[model samples]
Target: MVRYAFSKIGMTSTFTTNGSAQGVTVLKMQPARVLRHETLENGKVVVVVEYDTGHKNKLVRGWVVDNPAEYQVGSPLKAPSLNAGQKLKITGFSKGRGFQDAMTRHGFGGGPASHGSRFHRSPGSVGMRAEPGRVMKGKKMPGQDGNVQVTLRNVQVAYWSTEESVMAIVGGVPGARGGIVFV
Candidate 1:
C-alpha cells in the first residue's frame, strides 16, 4: 500500500490517510515562538517546541510531526529525515509546579487522609521576601504545568510502516499522552 499526497501548497501541507490506511501528513506553518535549544558537551543539538494538534480527537496515542530540516517561521521545513515506521523521540523536562500544601490538582485533599493532619492542602511560601527582594522569575509556582516544548533531534526511527503511515520512535517523548510532538 502506498500513500500519496495529491496536492501541494506553499503554506500548509496536508496529506490524506486514504486508500493505504496510512495516517495523514499535515505540516502546519505556525508562528515560531521561543524555542529552547540546548547544546550537549558532546556537540549534540536539542530543540523543543510546544506544539499543538488542532484536532479534537484526543484518544489517539502516537503520531509523528516532523520539523523542516531548515525552518524559518514563514518558510516550510524539509520533510523530516525519516519517514513512515521510523521514530523520533524528543525528551525534556516539563516545568514543575512548586510544592503543594493543597491536593487540588494532585488530588490531595479530595478524600480523607489517613494522617490526622488537618492542614492537608496548602502551598508552601512562594519564596522568602526582602532577602531576595523578588520571588525569582523561574521559581516554580502552583500554576500551569507541563506543556513544555522539547525537541530530541536525530532520534532513531524503528520503522516507517507505509501501509500504516506511522513512525515508531524509541524511548519516551515529552508532553502528556496525545501531545502534539513535532519531529
Candidate 2:
C-alpha cells in the first residue's frame, strides 16, 4: 500500500474560467493572503493561505513553498507564472457519495431479476470458511465512497488572465464548481 501524509499545505487563489474566441480558455485568479507558514529543517516549507472561492467555510488551504520567508501574514501574493498551452496537473478532492452497495460501489453483477432468484445486488459470500478464521483484509466490500483526493495530470492550460486573476484549462477538472484545484 502507498503510505501517505499531509506533509504540507498551501492555498490557490480564487479563479474562474472563461472560454475565449481563439479556442482557448482563460483563468482569472485573484490575489490570495498568506495566513501562516512553517519552515522545515530539510529545506521544505509549508504555507497556509486564504483563497476567494466563496465557499461556506473560509477557503483556507496549505501547500509547500519554495521560500516560506518571502511571504508574511496579510500579504497579497503575486500571480504565478503560467503560459498558454502549458500542461499541468490539478489535484483536489473528488465528490463524495456517502454509502453504496456492491452493484454500485464494487461493480458486482447482480442476479437476473426476471428469474426471481433473490440474489440480486448482493455482495455474495465475502467471508472465508474458517481456515484463516477471519475475513481477508482489503476485501472489496461496499462502504464509504468518494471524497478521496486525486490528481489529474497533463491537463493543458488554455490561457491565463493574470490581470483578472483567472485562468482557463482545456479539460474537465476535479471537484465541484468553485472548488479549488492545485496546479
Candidate 3:
C-alpha cells in the first residue's frame, strides 16, 4: 500500500456477526430535546438535540418528520402510540436499483430471445402515434428505480421492545438494512 503525504489514512474497524440480519432502523427516545439544527454534509440537516438537562448532546438523523421548525428546545417530543400485535403502515425508501428497464422496472413481458424477433426485454411501442400527439404522462418507461418512499400497508407487528426501541414486523419491509423506516 502506498501512502500519500497530503492525505492522512486511517484504519476502519469492522466486526463480523453471525446472528446479524437485516435489522430495521431502531430509534431510541433518550430524552433528547431538540436544540438547534444545521444543514451539513450529504444534504443531511443535523439536528443538534440535547438531553439530560443539556449536559449531553446528540445529533438526530433519519427522522420521518423533516421540518426542523417543528422541534424546539424545552419542549417534549410527542412520540406516536405504538403497541405490538397491531397492524401498522411502514413507510420507507426501498432499495435503490438506480436506472432500470421495463422488464425489471415495470415488469413488461418482452419479445422472445430467439432468432429474428430481436425485441427481447424491450418496452414495445411507448409512442401513442398521432391520436394524442404525445405519450401519456404516467408512462412506465426506463428510468430511476427504487429509493422512493413506498408504504407497506397492513404490516402486522410481530414484536415491539420499548427497552430496545425496535419493532419487528411480520413479513418483509422496504429499504436496505439500516435504512430509515418510519412506522
Q: What are the lDDT figures for the candidates, one per model?
A: 0.39, 0.64, 0.56
Q: For residue 40, what is the lDDT in candidate 1?
A: 58
- Residue-level lDDT tens digits of model 3 in 83-138: 76588776667789999998999888899889989899889987777898888989
Best by lDDT: 2
Number of the predicted model whose TM-score against the real structure is largest: 2
Q: Residue 54 of candidate 3: its Cα lDDT?
A: 25
lDDT of 1 by residue, 23-122 (tens): 2223222222224444557665444333323444321122122432333333322233455444444444444454443444345434445687554445
Better of 1 and 3 by TM-score: 3
User: TM-scores of the models, in the given order?
Assistant: 0.36, 0.75, 0.58
Worst 10 residues of 1 by lDDT: 1-10
Hey, what RMSD does candidate 1 come out at?
A: 12.9
For candidate 2, the per-residue lDDT at 99 reads: 94
Task: Give every collision pair in model 3.
Answer: none
Cα lDDT tens digits for candidate 2, 1-183 = 110111112223323356333332233453467888767788787788777654456567777877677777778777777797788776767778889987888788878787768887888888877698788999888898888898978977765666755676765555655455666
Decreasing lDDT order of the candidates: 2, 3, 1
